[model samples]
Target: MKTNRYLPLVGGLLLSLGSQAQTKLATGSQKPMPAAEWIDADTGHKIVRLTALDGANESFYFHNNPFVKSLGAAGDKMVYYHSSPAGKQLYALNLKTHQSEALTRPFARVHGEIVGKKRREVFYQVGDTVYATHIDSKKTRRVFVFPADFKADITTLNADESQLGGAWGSDAEKEIYRQYPAKSDFFNRIYEAKLPRTLFMVSADGNGQLTKLFTDNAWLNHVQFSPTDPRCLMFCHEGPWEKVDRIWTLDTKTKAVKLVHKRTMDREIAGHEWFGADGKTIWFDHQKPRGQTFAVTGANLQTGQEKSYAHTRDEWSVHYTSSADQKTFAGDGGYPTSVAKSAEGHWIYLFTPEGDHFRSEKLANLKTHDYKLEPNVHFSPDGKWLIFRANFEGQAQVYAVEIAKAAI
Candidate 1:
């Protein structure tokens, strides 16, 4: 195979054969091998026990966006949101029993992180009402609602609200910062309420003891909390009069404000990646004038020194995840499309182009400096099975290969 470093710009064509072939397994007969499990990088044990809930008949007909939004592994459950004709609905899939149930009824959208263990809490918006549902109990309670003309930007919330950096006592249970439509002159005012236009925090029990955090005439958008500390909140303050957007961090304890990063007239700074586990390092994509994209870098709380990882024209982003013992770093790598790890990390997943098809390789023991494997590799959580997601015909599916003996 030729080792060309550039990412292929070819049109979207599903390549079959080679590692993309679907194979049947013995243990999980009802589920296809490719869809059955995902190898855990840490222990090499198959972590995600997947089963096709719907849309399995048309071969290619599977979950369009069936990505797992939140995995409730501690509670032996998982929650995912799927787009439907009515709208997007949240579904709870029990991992142990392989049973599925719908948590939210049709109407409104469930934005932000879905919280909970066995019984999870889903923060969703309908019309003006913001509600939370306990998946196990099937109990739905109205948390808050938007005011008449107010709109909430759901994208502002972090993956699990774990990175909300503000001076709040605990993570805001049901808090949303809102803005009015573009045309409304009254859109600039900040309020603490359910929805419409409000920025307030609620108790876990749906009690609205709203406390006004800050009120500024400037249009505040994209409110995010620091991944390391909930008290440090960062938001973008934009106004019609201003030319460029400014990012600000608010110290909840001191109520002091600091300007972290600002953009000049010609360049705009966007894509804020707050390293949740490591508070200091923030990674973002920066577009250069030469038609090349560079991964902009920042420091975490501990390091307090800004640094950039190795540059690759293939395009790369940092995945903020510590190893099993938090001693090593691991993240997804692009360009060649693979997962990378720090020096001490054991497992590395890579994809190498083999003519028209691609092969997945698993490299172990970086310390020895000698590690290699065949393509289409998947590492189980316990390092027992290797599962691979492949595309066949016009359809994409998964396949698994036993790696328990191979790992030894």
Candidate 2:
């Protein structure tokens, strides 16, 4: 859709005013794949099990708005960080054979990207340093390292595959945790400190020459480059949704920064922002009075226009993801905690947003477990499949749903 075509004053805004839900039997025959079972869901989609560990530590979820792309080679392989009793590790699974190859082990909290046109190599971080490992040879190389005082967190590769982007907070992160007890234990906070928080864009190879794109006193995070515009990137002020403006965009060429979805009211809470397929519009979830109500919103970065649909009451998602075309969106209400406290029970959902209205269908009903459904929900490059994390079996696992063209 044209970015400027959604202007409110021009009578062009598409507004979905309220919430609704539907459940129906899914249609589709099961595909023959190893270590996998298929079930027909009420959304007329087929859900495929990518992993089959029962009551085991099978989590593949990484983080919300992750900088790394998990699916590789047109959905033939999926790279994910998994935690087990043995240790935390990274693996790549063959979608058809159900066979997985370990890429690295003894790794700490991680985010990874599969590189090259052939996707034979992977790059990931093991703390403050980023490393690259060969998928077949298991040989590794150190790609980049942050300053001794800085610890890089989430990482992403740019559109041209020439640069990598990431953000790190100053030493204030430790003091924040010490002074305030975090109810969720997740890293979302805005503290009163003078420590420097910087966003870096590093070269993808060799010494990985690093470039500081922006820095601020606030917590900077979720650094992602536009998929089509290499010089443009987006980051967020990480904190409680209502306390921060939350999103901002930066131009690497001109070194300019612009606030995205800037607060327009006293109680508006917006976060989990991401760019559309064309980079013309940005999507995020917004609500007033915190958890009471919310809507999935889209804003034109170039024209200053906006549109929203899929409204809901206290039951909306804490994070969301949409297809490249912006025609379909999926999310869950699960918070960061384990399934016991923050489970969605209703599980994942798919929304088909139309001109001022939207239709929602329950895509997957993930029963309660030790893991909460995460917000890594994403569509394949071709939009033929949707992928997400769930713990329907006890431990978290990744799954994909074959999206029926007619469903959207």
Return the top candidate by lDDT.
2
Candidate 1: minimum summed lDDT over ten consecutive residues — where? 56-65
lDDT by residue for model 2 over 98-149, one digit each (tens)? 4566778746655654343333567777767788776657788888877786
Best-fitting candidate, measured by TM-score? Answer: 2
Across 119-141, the per-residue lDDT of candidate 1 in tens digits comes to 24655566556676776677888
TM-score, every prediction: 0.51, 0.77
Write down the TM-score for model 1: 0.51
Please report the TM-score between candidate 2 and the true structure: 0.77
**In candidate 2, which residue ranges exceed 4 Å CA deviation?**
1-45, 54-75, 106-120, 135-139, 178-195, 335-345, 369-375, 404-408
